[model samples]
Target: MLRLHRSALYYVRPLLRAALELTPSKSDTPVTFVPTVAGLLVRAQNENVAIEFTVEGAGSGAPISVPYGSLAKVEGRQHEPLELAATLEGNVFRWSEVGIPQVLSAPALEPAAWPSLPAQDCANDAELLTALREAAATTDIASLRYSLGCIRFRGDGGQLAATDGRQAILLSGFRFPWSGDVLARRCPVFTKLRLAATDERHVGRTEDWLVFRAPRWTLWLKIKHEARFPDVESQIPAREQADTTLSLAEADATFILQKLKHLPGGADQNEPITIDLNGSVAVRAKNDSSSVTELVLSSSERSGAQVRCCSDRRYLQRAVQLGFREILFRGTAAPLFCRDTRRAYVWALLSAEHCLKHNEQATRIASPRAATAVQWANSESNSGS
Candidate 1:
């Protein structure tokens, strides 16, 4: 028999929703009620992610396999305690409120069928969330290549990175305590696991699974240790190694992003925008349909170099959105680089005439030779910690 407050179920409802989101609706055993020394654990799993959380219930019996929808339908207006009493005929669980004739019942799952829980370790939530958001920004959400689509957690340098073929983002300052380099899918589940800075979060691993425990819940996802992630550090230009640097104030960058966002296309397939950094910063975008509408914005900052380059509007907007105000150009052919205190981003540059000719199917600006662009020590001074 087990007993706990009905409000406990309400508290972990968000966690349950996150778990169910990762799995199909019709899975045989979407949720399992397990009896542990700490409390009654509600757990669920799929191929990519698993979720578990504890409620203050007391009982010992075979685990129950109830549909999440069935549990979600239970109703109680006033605060009431819930009880699950073990019975002989197939282990049925029943709960009822005081002075209420209605009762809710669910069938229990056999103990032999439930998967075992693994051991755990402490994890820093603040650092983990920050790394996930930064690295996941550039990951190809729909790519078939795991290396390009998933975020790589490397233990050696305590770094996290992700890349699509066209652009990449990397962040330092993470001290992952894993055995080696591990790859995790950029699932929206991590974004939903919101917690306070003081909450206790934990991580654990088995041979095939990586488990994460929140203050009220636990999650297990498959671990990819053998995957080969690209070397993002080598591709990014050092602060002193960029040729032409263009610095934009936050207001200027935000203005450009806001203007270019509504132009024509979505994030992946957007129109090309030309950026001219001669004596000042000038941005121009045009629509060459039946009505050729042109848009231009200029900044008063005169510290820019005399270089003009074309870039995907979405990529530029993403770079600015990640708080990268300094744009570094390695000649006109090499990739564009930008960095802040802990994050470094690099994206391919597009040719102005080629994009104009090809329309929506623009190609990368070809580089004639890999020549080291001019380096400026002053560019490093703009970076903030």
Candidate 2:
């Protein structure tokens, strides 16, 4: 019999669910519970990644494997703090809540038959998770450019880079122990698991796998070939190449973001929003039926030039979200560039033809100036009512 706090189980539930996500729906997933001196060790894996964590408590019995499908049906309240005892008898595994009469049972599998997992001895101190996540966000998962689906960690200066062809992010100053470059697929599990501050994070590499390890849990991602990835350093434009620069104030950024919240197609990050700089900064978003156009900041607020560019709304939003106050634009055909202290982002601006086509569509709707005022007035009126 094994007794453990429900809090411990709840703490590891996200990892379990993330493991489930790694496999296809039709597959019958088994979560192995190995009897360890510390407590119970839960392990799950798929083709792309594997995850396991030790839940420390009381345990004394043979290791048992339980199907996640059956376990999910009776996992009980997740947020409630309680104690539970589990026991494996013959082919069935059962767990009952302490102080409660309710007991749940699930079919069991032979623990010895479970596939062996890779050993983790992660001592690398590169702190690559944060950089990996930021670079991974720029990868193109659905594109045929397979190389763009992976993040490259350069051993030279510990630079992490990824691009979706449309956008790219580069993070420098990471210190990796590996002397050669490593290309790793941007797996969601790496970013999904939350690491506690108390837990010492480390990265490990074997012949075939790259491992991310913490105190109680570890995850491994398959390494990819770096031969296909493009030379990221050469792709970034030189500082002098920028022909126009817009330094937005905090208030200007906030107003633009607020207006975006009310715009159509908030769900589609790829939706185009044109930023026009003439005497004022005008932001516009339009769909088939409705359109939103507003002058977020006047030229008096900041110096302006006659330049216009269409960009992915999410790309722009991400720059603002990352506390980037200044963005550089070379021309409509050039990529937009922004950077913080350690990271730089390059967003490919939509072509002039694309912007023109969208503008023609917007012509069917009310003029930007009038439409924005009307929408703002209507919203205010509705709120007052």
Candidate 1 residue runs with Cα over 4 Å from true position: 4-27, 36-38, 56-62, 75-101, 104-107, 110-125, 202-204, 264-268, 290-304, 354-385
Clashing pairs in 2: none
Q: In model 2, which regions exceed 4 Å deviation?
A: 19-27, 78-91, 97-105, 110-128, 264-270, 288-292, 298-305, 354-385
Best by TM-score: 2
Q: Candidate 1 clashing pairs? A: none
Q: What is the number of residue pairs that collide in model 1? A: 0
lDDT for each residue of candidate 2 in 1-385, tens digit (9 for 90 to 100): 5555555665666667764463447335767777787777777765656677887665666666666664444444543333333443433434445656555555665543433344544343434566667787888867776588788877677678999887788888765556677887777655676666566777656766667777787776667754478776666676567777787766556545555655665555577777776555666666666655444453213243567777878888888876777788777777888866677888778766535222433432222243265565466457863
Cα lDDT, all candidates: 0.64, 0.64
TM-score of each: 0.75, 0.77
Task: Write down the TM-score for model 1.
Answer: 0.75
- lDDT (Cα, tens digit) per residue for candidate 1, span 67-99: 555555453444677766656554344456566
Count of steric clashes across candidates, in order: 0, 0
